[model samples]
Target: MGDPHPKIEARAVTRVFGRAARAVHALGPVDLTVAPGEFTCVVGPSGCGKSTLLRIAAGLLRPSSGELRIRTNARRPAAMIFQDYGIHDWKTVLANIRFGLDVQKVPRREADARAAHWLDRMGLTDFAAAYPAALSGGMRQRVAIARALAVEPEILLMDEPFAALDAQLRTILQDELLGLTQTTRTTTLFITHSLEEAIVLGDRVLVMSARPGRVIAERRPPFPRPRTGAVRATPEFAALTSELWELLRGEVGAGAAA
Candidate 1:
């Protein structure tokens, strides 16, 4: 079948919010595509509509104009992992991971088995019976990821999932995520403000302009997976980060000024 098509595609998608007096142009005529088994990261200054773009791709919000398409054989469109680890406080780790499967009417036993498999793989088996409140920030985010993978969707949409963790924990989780992606090969669209993260994790990085965001640059990383601490110190990695910073610094300053 001619190698199939992109797992998700966005064609001139735009999103605007609020009424005339308070109307905000969050995004404008953005075009992007995420291929199967590829990892793409979107980065930009604050309030540049990075999150808005990701939400549109996930079908969580409809674009005000243009088209967002997700092609998948699975009934569930895409699974999202939020920055805040959006797990239910009342639900135990295992239960939270199984929620999507439960909603889709997968057999309870099968769902439990799948949850256990991911929990062990994610190193969260011991915490399965614990509630969200009991887990550390990193552990909670792991649960969020496991929950998304439970649904076995065609794409994973992540919105700064590691931003809230401490620097050390964030780095640790970043490496863990790289390993997870390698094993699962899930098409992913990850959003982040960290240039280091974008360089380290993404196969390609898309840089956006200031508010009313539009793609300003696209960079392909030269490193191979699984990306490690060593890659970050390489000349190629440093050069990519410097280039991305040059593109983003002005937008960041402008956003802050406004």
Candidate 2:
């Protein structure tokens, strides 16, 4: 049979900030496709427009050229998690998780049930009434993640959601995320600077050049599916991480100079 249609497709996508001589060419002429149930990660230098590419996919920013297409029948087609933990302080943990459902006008009872389910799954059940200020950075991030997952989005765009956490906590959440996404088979696009993270979490890892970023290399982890943190212990994982770093090392210097 023919290949199934892409869940997310971008063709010659580009983004520019400002205009005239002040124009900052932030991203693309990039082309990429994410198939249904795929987890893709992007790794690049600091100024490489990694986040710009994600924001464009999220429909939060308009690209200067090219096109982005998302094909999914999900009531909420996409949900995004940011590094800063996008949960609202004004909303309690339960309410924060239910926010999207509320916006979609889901029945109040159903929304509450769904939110509560995710709260328990994320280990936030006891903190249902707590505000963002009352939680630690890790817990607040969990609330943000629970809120996104409660909506059951077809596409999950995560921009270094675990980047700020301590190493132990980051691994804990990474393993949790691996299990969740594998079970749901959600199409995910994760952007991170950590090569090990990209390898551990992504089926396919794409490397980008500096500044005006473009895909420089694409590598798929040879590891099997339903992966956990143990995959990082294998020799292949180390080699692949080293390979990606070499591809990115020069770009890092270039981005710094730019």
Candidate 3:
């Protein structure tokens, strides 16, 4: 079911890199809508432009054609969490978490309150004074997530935020993220290479085709929300995985070849 009121709308959005001489078609004139509080994940082959799609939505890149609108009724923009954990090494964990609020000129009292809340939720209260260098990859990503969420944006865009973590920690963060997003009901557009991650975290999972990417399949996991990693063990999860693998595996190989 779609949200009666959508938070993000991408209409016939297309992205191309470079000019005529050396052009690369990145994404589609694909239409996408994110309902407030919905978590939508996209999975595709390597060159399929999953990240490109996110960049356009984040307003980091303008679509080559068509329009991408954020919170149509307001001006609030989306916040993005990157795979590399884009936190400043010179800043303390708390400081990094509060950076967005600071930029927006949020009052110190309220900014501090928001930062502290997210740090605690992200399980980073103990590392508030630590720098990015001192934290594990997983911990660093938590800070990145905390920083993004602290701003309380209507839309969240994530680009493989957990792809660098060890398998065990990735699983842990995936569960934590699932819980956090569901609790907040934040609308999210996440990109991932892992099909399991896509199915586990997304209320809906979108599969994209090769370069010049366009959504080829959309899967709505029938499982109820509040998903923990344990859901990955179910028969339903396996079936979904198998179904998507057929569409994604060749793309994966194709992506690698490219």
Candidate 4:
């Protein structure tokens, strides 16, 4: 069983862009938590501050009101993988993977060893010398994952990291991620628009409303872990997906109507 204490916690967190009359209430009064070693996914209508909440968790953005608590002894605390891959064009695949380890001041030889391990794991060993320009979309995303994992972050935050890939590639990476997270037991918070993806990847799926996003519903799939594409074929999977969509449909429609 995972720790009862929250690895990540938010209390009435909110965000607003600009001031007064022009102020755009982007998120919250949202409250949520992720237990240690848990994989939690968030789904919401477009422009619903899913990314804003993620940014707050990543400490890249501060909430306008309320608080976020991330409990980790590690210096970096978290590693984030973005949809854009976020690797440097100037660095080789190997360098990109080592970048975070280096920042942690992991020794040179240790960093190289750790980077090499992830390169092999991500199947990027062949492209170790190549820059981001040389890799395919899926390959680039793998590199991004490798870089994030190499740091051994206490919490992993992903913002639709596989969303841009084709369906086939997305499934492949999803399984790979499931396997890695299961093995490492890294706490993760993922954001996606796909209810199927959220159901497939998360231990619990959180649904958010349209703009000024607030988590309005949550669902936990009954299927057991080491989950893969095989789970999608089960009736239970379909039922859960339908259930989450029912909760989301109105919010999505409202966002569209707005």
Q: Mind giving the per-residue lDDT tens digits that candidate 1 earns over 1-258?
A: 433688888899889998798989899689998888999999999999999998888778999999989888878878999998989999999999999999999998899899999999889999889999988999999999999998887789999999999999999989888888878888999999999998888999999998889998999999877667668889998898998999999999988887
lDDT of 2 by residue, 178-207 (tens): 999999998999999999999999999999
Q: Please provide, for model 4 over 84-202, each residue's C-alpha lDDT reduced to its tens digit, 9 standing for 90 to 100.
A: 99999999999999999988899999999999999999888889999999889999999999999999999999999998999999999998998899899899999999998888888
- For each candidate, what is the lDDT? 0.90, 0.93, 0.89, 0.93
TM agreement with the true structure for every prediction: 0.96, 0.97, 0.94, 0.98
Deviating ranges (above 4 Å) for candidate 1: 1-4
Q: Of 2 and 3, which scores higher on lDDT?
A: 2
Instruction: Give the Å shift of residue 234 in candidate 3.
Output: 0.4
In model 3, which residue pairs have backbone atoms overlapping below 3 Å? none
For model 4 the local lDDT of residue 170 reads: 95
Model 4 worst lDDT run, 10 consecutive residues: 221-230
lDDT comparing candidate 2 with the true structure: 0.93
Q: What CA root-mean-square deviation does each model show from the true structure? A: 1.4, 1.2, 1.8, 1.0
Cα error, residue 52 of model 1, in Å, equals 0.6
